[model samples]
Target: MKTNFQKNKIVEHPKESLAPKSGDKKDYTQSEFEEFIIKSGAVGSYMIFRSENEEDEMGISEL
Candidate 1:
């Protein structure tokens, strides 16, 4: 079986805060981000990994 997938352009990074900023508040916690994703109609697997440099990373794949 052959599988084909089209690349998607990520206009916004997941780690970026989706809520409007007020004063110096511009970061979203993990739970808040997850909530935003769910509300945005995202349905698939979400993965969190660590890069070779030990920096944390995450991504969401829509199935």
Candidate 2:
């Protein structure tokens, strides 16, 4: 038996209010990000977002 260990970097997603000052004021929510990942059909994709004090993670569906 063999085991493989690989480390990967996680990219953080931008929150609505965290957008740049010059950026649009559109509301960015969790669902919107999820939709984008789903529509793009990306595999092994995850999102990182900050809320309150802790970081979060979300994955796309395998459908």
Candidate 3:
């Protein structure tokens, strides 16, 4: 018996966050991000925004 090691495979790395300013926000959750992906059938990219609330609420949305 011979083993075939010539098969091509792709390895994808975990997505990385952009700048720190966006990450600091705390309103948006991962589920929302995933929902957007599922509803839209795809998510090319996304971004975070800090609202002008007294407590400075933050959330994630499509970029």
Best by lDDT: 3
Model 3 regions lying over 4 Å from their true place: 1-23, 43-63
Residues 20-58, model 3: lDDT tens digits:
675577657999988997998774455444667634454
Residues 1-63 of candidate 2: C-alpha lDDT, one tens digit per residue: 235687558879676555467766766788998899799876454445545634323433562
Worst 10 residues of 3 by lDDT: 54-63
Q: All candidates' lDDT scores?
A: 0.64, 0.63, 0.66
Q: How many clashing pairs does model 3 include?
A: 0
Give residue 14's lDDT in candidate 3 (0 to 100): 75
Clashing pairs in 3: none
TM-score of each: 0.25, 0.26, 0.28
Which candidate, 1 or 2, would have the higher lDDT against the true structure? 1
Across 8-58, the per-residue lDDT of candidate 1 in tens digits comes to: 686866775565666856466889988988899665565456676553344
Between prediction 1 and prediction 2, the one with superior TM-score is: 2
Model 2 error, position 29 (Å)? 0.3
Residue pair clashes in candidate 1: none
CA RMSD, predictions in order: 12.3, 13.9, 15.5
Rank order (by TM-score, best first): 3, 2, 1
